[model samples]
Target: MSERQRYAVLNLPAVPEVSAIKIVFNRRSAIIITFTTPEKEHIQG
Candidate 1:
């Protein structure tokens, strides 16, 4: 098996756009979580 290449904007097939996004974290905590429909997955799939 081959290793997957990381994401690169210059390697993308189309103009990336985001319709929704969210960033979750506690004000007293340092942890953070992000959730979004990545443009790459959205179109490629």
Candidate 2:
């Protein structure tokens, strides 16, 4: 017999036209980050 996979859908709110987003990840005492602009451009650091 095989198990079924479940998935969930997330509905995110609309971002402001002039807003920017940032994401950060930490691994083994190192930090990686990403920046996003309102125009949907990704900046890596």
Measured against the true structure, the TM-scores of the candidates, in listed sequence, are: 0.25, 0.32
| Highest lDDT scorer | 2
For candidate 2, give the lDDT. Answer: 0.44
What clash count does candidate 1 reach? 0
Global CA lDDT computed for model 1: 0.37
**For model 1, how does the per-residue alpha-carbon lDDT over 1-45 read when each residue is reduced to its tens digit?**
123432432243532364443333477744342324554433221
- Model 2: residues >4 Å from true position, as ranges? 1-18
Candidate 2 C-alpha lDDT tens digits along 4-41:
21111112344465255344546663434454666657
Error of 2 at 22 (Å): 3.1
Off by over 4 Å in 1: 1-16, 26-28, 31-35, 38-45
Q: Which window of 10 residues has the lowest lDDT sum in candidate 2? A: 1-10
